[model samples]
Target chain A: MNYTDVFGEPTRGKYVIAGINVGMILRKDWTTHQQARDYLCDFDGEPQIVEGIDDEFIREKHKEYPHLSLADCEYMWTGAHFCEELLKFDGFMLHASAVVYKERAYLFSAPSGTGKSTHTKQWLDAFGEDAYILNDDKPVIRLLNGKAVVFGTPWSGKTDQNRNAGVLLGGICFLERADENWIKPVGAKDAAFGILNQTIRPGDKKRLVKLLELLDNVIKTTGVFRMGCTISTDAAIMSYDAMKGETRA
Target chain B: MKVKSDFVLKEVAGQWIVAPSGDASISFNAMITLNDSGAFLWKTLEGGASEEELVSALLGEYEVSEETARAGVRNFVEKIREANLLDD
Candidate 1:
């Protein structure tokens, strides 16, 4: 019942994504101002949602309360938005979900309703616990020591699966709904565009270029792919193989 | 203006190339090289090379006489300065 205690459970995992130690706290509810404050302040996790009668509900609905700082509220929600790890791991967060297979992580990127969650679930069921979801909604990626590493985060769009960070990145897969499933290597320009499409940041041309630079480094190292698939693990498996190469360790 | 004496240069992240003690870091996509005269002028600017010293070094290293070196080095030093690749 203690949100803070759950979130601030000593961060026993190997890595901490965003601000929350995602390992201990799966999909759960936090329902009081004290609980919300404790949860937010404890691990410095952002307050993602104050809904479901948790804390700070001025009215009976999930709508924003006027007295509450909407700006701060939104900020709180995104506190643990992505992998903000490693000192200068300058990278952008995308509207994507990723899974870790072996030591390498594979990213399933898309805007909303583009089958990110559905594909992630397929990967999980297909690979079972062998594959782990980084963040189903807002996954973070950064370039560190000249490499792009993906981090597991706490923000899930009603997703139940939870864990700490993953290892290095496998590859980035930009999803497209297709009649049949197929995977293809993305060209450098297309790859850059794919990354850019999912990029989340406020900016002008200069900032966008900076983000592009970070993304360029990621594509240079991680490789990008375009995947067309039906709602089946077979497609997920194909996407995985394209990113991960052969099956099994 | 240029420095006087030995300066080393290095490039980082396809961005800038700079000397350890040099006052500037030059960013160019292509590799920048210095000719004998330019190298000599660059060398003379070791302890913060000056425009005159750069010319003198160019004269010493190239076939040009001191006067020509002075003018050429002066122009070249201006370019280097504009590129933000050298100390004043």
Candidate 2:
């Protein structure tokens, strides 16, 4: 039997991201009115402040939401709002889409519409069910003992797949699609820039320095790459193979 | 002096982020993180102050020459403006 039943409940699935323990609890009720009853979840003293939901409301809200929900949380929970709290609690949210391939997490991050979801789907189609998708939207990145670890939260893009969490960043991809498929390794400075851009934070001189420092530490331990590819499965496989080589390009 | 100015800012999500019209973005990646000096400069010039006002404030606060202060502030302001972080 699966140790975890559903998201948002006490189970083996509960784990810590950074120093913050993201505990989940799930509730299911058939009544449409019953769904409307809002529940409150707290992160330390800060409340999730979730409004009640009924089945229709949930379905409707789901349709209107910009992001996906693995469980039944609101899509408004962004990395910027939570990462600082998570960081203060010793955790941080990663600003990227994540998928688990061969039990390893691969992240695609860059500016919006840089094919993060498209790349994730490409990998999924290429690998079939052999690969699992964690988050196609906002995935959390936490540092464990100074090593970068990626977590799959319930939050995702339009895809409703609520896969469980995974640890260890197999590789990070900063996408820049071209006419041809190619995977290039990036150096610390470029990698730092790419990763820092994908991090959930504010922009200014001081923050830039801090982001630079954060990305520097993250890229030093976790390898970084620039994936220039097409929408082909071959390109997806090429990226996977490239990352497996484990050498900076 | 008719010195010109622009928006004030900080870094969020690894990009040069800023605040416009005195309101900041709600997302973490959208929030601008500023250092003490940058924050100070940002707030001072945030009221849409002119270049002269900005330079004068910097001169008074940081013990820097007018040319140096103007040049440095201009460069900083230029970077943020290029990123479109300014309000108006």
Candidate 3:
């Protein structure tokens, strides 16, 4: 399964993601991005598997989203592997729209087509200069010294919306569409179930252990909530107010 | 009865979460969270313990009486069995 033999010397690039230097080997058609390229250095990155990824694995992933190009599948495969590796550093990626307001990051996670983007857009419109999308999709969370921190990454879906930023995670809210806007606090146990749907689960038992441990810290250290919202600025403000721990007037 | 190999239990932040993994991961959406006593029964059942054996372990581990131990083991065993997480 040595990819170097199958495809000539893979494109090796070092990039800092989630504040960890990763020397990722991208094969044939997989691509890199400028966002991470800014953090390039000679510092040694962790060594990871470059050849064990199977064709059946890529095809199975592609079957879930057929619109993805071969290159997208290749890159997605690498991203999943990076996430698996990120587990060791107390980090893992969440499929969420992370927004930065007042310098703190708030992540909103949900299943696709669930208006995760539309709701976050309301935050942008509501707070023009004060709010920005840190990563529109797939932001990385790392528990640093018992504090949850969210970091922007290059593989931010098709929107390409991301910042080379790491902000203290303020809260993580699982979003849902509702006729009216409302928010409520969620316990850590319930947060685990909501989070499991949005994050990549590793294949083996050992890494799965790391993931659960990190997940425990992330949920415990940050505020977790569930919000039923509509695509309105008021809904955004309501969620923002609750997540930011601001008192309602 | 015994716990299936498809499921793995681990303690995270003093809580026990049981989730299906490997090939059985895709088809199920159920995840079981257990307390200290439930986790003990799960670890014991991993090697296949009888109902009486589970009750005895519960009695020995905690300072509970026989009736309470029997009820605790009964309730915990029924739950895993219902979740199909046990190989009975």
Candidate 4:
């Protein structure tokens, strides 16, 4: 079945995500989600067209995830297709709340409902003008000139907080709820494991290899920390101080 | 028995990591790290070597005795088997 025949004239939206130009093509009937639309930008140069998943594949996915809504299916298809295209340009999506602080990005990653967003919010509240949300969720990390930089994506989670800018990744912190605030440096192996847990691992073998390699480089270049804390400004300050080497306590 | 086809061994930052790929990675849900001896044995076992061959290879590379090599290989194999990364 021809994609164009089924979806009709596709609505093209161009976005510059993580320094790469992406042109999203979808059925005109289906509107781009608001989260992604917020980051949309005009791309003057040649853009890579991210075609929507074919109907047959969508049917199979619907069968696999019977409870998903039509909108869910469309979002999953578009995200998967765009991510696959982005991988070709050495970019991969990470499930984390990224905040820009002191001209660098610090990513807070944890399982859903584990307070990643809350912790980043604390950072913003504490730092005031010094910190801003790069992306509340699903930021794209790309390897540029041997540095792992984080860029805001349209797929930012619930808050829809994101900017189209990119920042050099300075650190990553895995959050765990605890009685008191504390932070410690994590080893490379542990850091990789945390990153893998938060990253969207592709099923394709070639893409999976690239993901693993990129993750390794990210761990090697960026500071990794494991923070245990409660929901307070102290949690944010403790982590920030540890990461910045301002204080050991 | 051998290391499963779906698992790939990667050396990152001077450490060895075994990561699942393809469909297995989707459900495997975990990664395993191997020490120097485990990495050596894993690479050796990729060719489907025997226990005795593994012990011999271990002794050739390290300063351990035959008995130590055998014990190390047995322990490594047992750990991988528990992780379901070996096709026995």
Which prediction has the highest TM-score against the true structure?
A: 4
Better of 2 and 3 by lDDT: 3
TM-score of each: 0.53, 0.55, 0.86, 0.89
Ranking by DockQ: 4, 3, 2, 1
DockQ values of all predictions: 0.03, 0.12, 0.47, 0.56
Candidate number with the higher DockQ (1 or 4): 4
Query: For every candidate structure, what is the RMSD over all alpha carbons to the true structure, in angstroms?
Result: 11.9, 8.8, 3.8, 3.2
Q: What digit string (tens of lDDT, one per residue) describes model 3 on residues B1-88?
A: 8998767787655568886666656644557899989999999999888999999999889999999999999999888888878776
Q: Summarize candidate 3's per-residue lDDT along A1-249 as a digit string, tens digits.
A: 335434334556666767877666555435443344554556654633232354555567778889986457766766777777787788899999999998788899999999998988999999999899989989999888777888988778878788878998888899999999999998767788788778877666677767888877776667889999999999989988998852111
Clashes of 1: 22
Candidate 2 chain A lDDT trough over 10 residues, lowest sum: A30-39
The global C-alpha lDDT for each of the candidates, from Candidate 1 onward, is 0.55, 0.57, 0.78, 0.78
For residues A1-249, write the lDDT of model 2, one tens digit per residue: 122323223221233333354443223341211221221123463232222222344445567763655333333432234554554433455567787877678888867887888887888899998887777777767666676677665445555454546567788888877899988877654664455456554433344344444555566667678878898898889989888646222
Question: What would the DockQ be for model 1?
Answer: 0.03
Question: CA lDDT of A82 in candidate 3?
Answer: 73
- Runs in model 2 deviating more than 4 A are A1-19, A22-73, A78-80, A202-213, A245-249, B1-88
DockQ of 2: 0.12
lDDT of 1 by residue, B27-72 (tens): 2211243544555555566556556656655655668777776777
